[model samples]
Target: MSLLEIEDLRVTFATEAGPVEAVRGVSFSLSRERLGIVGESGSGKTMTGRSVLRLIRAPGRIEARRMSFDGIDLARIPEREMRALRGRRIAMVMQDPKYSLNPVMRVGRQLTEGLRLRDGMSARAARAKALEALEAVQIRDPERVLEAYPHELSGGMGQRVMIAMMLIPEPDLLIADEPTSALDVTVQAEVLRILDGLVRERGMGLMFISHDLNLVSRFCDRVLVMYRGRIVEEIEANRLSQAQHPYTRGLLNCLPTIGGPRQPLPTLTRDAAWLE
Candidate 1:
């Protein structure tokens, strides 16, 4: 069975313009492999990830015909049970660690908080686990990093810490929304390597959401191309260049080539039929 299954998932928000559907009848399944969701900023990639954890706030509503994780019905689970499953069974790594990590809290505290509070690990044990997790992500001087504040770490370092904290629980699935979008090419490669290693070693399903089609094509096994609020096409990562959808083709055309073209990049043309 798939690690995660989502069918006809819809997310909507009430607005002066009436109800706005952010995610329109999306359906997909994930196994113990990397699945990438690629689209523009308003394409509902992030919302789909957040809805899996029932993180949609007031004003925003999530509805689905079915949403399950590991045989458990996520759409029907009580809030308390869902809370218990959130960090221990499923984890998320946001795009920007600066916004995800608490500025006021020390890194060590944030990393160990769920371990101690949710898992009921003792302070010493939690600290040890936190150190181990930090090390797993190739963070040198784990002790020093644990003592530092979120703001004290560089963008790359902060992102690594976020990955560490999320992995500390050893979740069955991870939803990473643009995890390396804020870093340089070198740092991004490092972060991707760490994520790749963890996914392979732990056999965890990963839902990687990103706007970078090239990166997604390289990193993921399967790619779901989202346009507007729906998935317009699904293709093998290696065959992304052969996508038949017009929107997917347009997105691919917009990617700047290394030594190929020096002229102006092509503008993406939109079709209203894509929303239907």
Candidate 2:
């Protein structure tokens, strides 16, 4: 059975103009594999990830014909049960760690809090686990990092620390929403490497949300190209070069070629028919 199954998922927000459909009739299934959701901003990739965890607030509502994680029916589950599932069974690594981490709290305390509360571990044990998780993400000087405040860390270090905190609970699935977007190219590679290694070793399902088509194609097993709040194309990562959808092709063509002739990046031309 699939680790996650979402069918006819729709997210809507109440606006002065009318109800805006942010995610429209999306359907997909994932197992213990990487599934990439890629699109331009406001295409609803992030909303889709948030909806999986029931993170949508008032004035915004999620409706779906079916949504399940493992054998649990997420659509029908109680909030209490869903809370237990979150962070313990399914965790999300947000796009920006600066916003995710608490400025006043020390990094080690934040990491240990979840372990102690969720796993019923002693403070000493939780700290040990926190340090181990830091090392697992290839963070050098885990002890030093643990003691530092979130504001003291660089963008890359902050991101790694976020990843470490999320992984400390040993979740079955991870929703990484552009986890490397705020980092340098080199740091991006390092973060991806750590995520790739963890997914492989742990056999965890990953819902990787990103705008970078090339990165998704390289890192994911399957790709879903969303446009205007709907999935316009679904392609195997290995077959991304042969994507048939115009939106997917347009995105791919926009990527600059290294050491190639200089040219203006292609602008994406939208078709109204795609919304239907």
Candidate 3:
């Protein structure tokens, strides 16, 4: 069964000029697989993911004909019910770990607090669970990490901690929004490996949101390209280079070739009526 189902989902912001449609009729389903959503800023990729969790702020309104996860209707669920569903059944890993982690609290307490909230775990049980989560994310000296403050950890280490905290709930679906964007290349690769491992081992559904086309093509099973508030193309990861849309083709060509001829890359030109 599909772990998530979204149909005709739309999000609009009440701007001063008028209603700005951020997401227009975007829909997709995910199972035990990695689904990549890629686009430049203002392309509606992140908004779609946020709308799924009803995370859109007050000025932004989300409307969907149907939105579901695990056969439960998310759009119809109450705020309290949605809260219950969020951390326990579905989890999100935001772009920056520094912003997500509390600076004042010790890492161990903050990490275990997630488990306590969703699962009502005892302090002892939460600690054990936190340790296990840290181990799964390949953090060395999990006990030491637990005792350190967020400021004491490196960017990679902080991201690993965030992943551990989110995974402690054993959520069925994981939405990672540009999870490695703030890190260096090496750290990005490491973070992806940890995410890949968890998704593969647990057979969990993953919605990986990013603008890194090359990485998305390699790591995900299927890739969805967004432009101007719509999905412009969808293709298997292996077939990304063969995508038919002009936008998709341009994106693939724009990627810098490693150790190959070094030259200025051509930028993408937009067309407003291509989808028509």
Candidate 4:
């Protein structure tokens, strides 16, 4: 069964120029597997992920025929009820940890805040859980990390802490929006390994939003190619090279291969018909 489902999801913003649709009529379902959404900036990949959690606010609005998670209707749920589900059931890791983590707060306080406030965990127990979560992500010095502030850690360490924070709740579905975009190749691989192991062991669904086609093809089970706010094609990750859509083909062709060519990478040609 699907852990999350969406049909005709639309995200719009009120602009002086009129209404701008950031995510237009996109739909998909996710089981307990890694599903990747790949697209260039402005293709609505991040918007779609945020819409599932009802994170859009103010000038932005979300509308959908159906959006549900674990048999619960996300669209119809009260904000109070949604708040209860946010971390405990569905968690999201933002692209940058510097902005996401409170700069003034210690890592331990941030990690244990949700548990103590929402789950009513004792301070001692929450600290222990936080340490375990850090260890799971391969942070060798968990105690030092818990005491340090966000700025005290490196990009890779901060990202790992974000993952650990989300995993502490043992959420059923995790939406990671460019979680490793800022990390170096070595750290990126380590983060992916940690995420893969956690998802497999816990049987949690993952919506991995990224623009790296090569990485998505290798890491995810299924791939959704988005173009101009719509899914242009869906294909098995292993067979992405054989995708039938011209947009998907164009994207694959644009990837720069090592030792393949010395010339500049080819530019992606856009087609208006692909938006239809």
Best by lDDT: 1
Worst 10 residues of 4 by lDDT: 263-272
Q: What lDDT tens digits, residue by residue, belong to model 4 across residues 1-276?
A: 699999999999999999999999999999999999999999999999999889999799999999989999999999999998888899999889899999999999999999999889999999999999999999999999999999999999999999999999999999999999999999999999999999999999999999998899999999999988999999999998899998888888887787988888887787789889
Runs of candidate 4 with Cα error greater than 4 angstroms are: none
Clashing pairs for model 1 are none
Where model 1 places Cα greater than 4 Å from the true spot, the runs are none
lDDT of 1 by residue, 1-276 (tens): 999999999999999999999999999999999999999999999999999999999799999999999999999999999998887889999999999999999999999999888779999999999999999999999999999999999999999999999998899999999999999999999999999999999999999999999999999999999987899999999998899999999998987788978899987889899999
Ranking by lDDT: 1, 2, 4, 3
Clashes found in each candidate (C-alpha, N, C closer than 3 A): 0, 0, 0, 0
Q: Which residue window of length 10 is worst by lDDT in model 3?
A: 267-276
- Tens-digit lDDT string for candidate 2 (176-235): 999999999999999999999999999999999999999999999999999989999999
lDDT scores in order: 0.95, 0.94, 0.91, 0.94
Candidate 1 accuracy as TM-score:
0.97
Off by over 4 Å in 2: none
Error of 3 at 242 (Å): 0.6
Model 4: lDDT to the true structure: 0.94
- Residue 141's lDDT within candidate 4 is 99
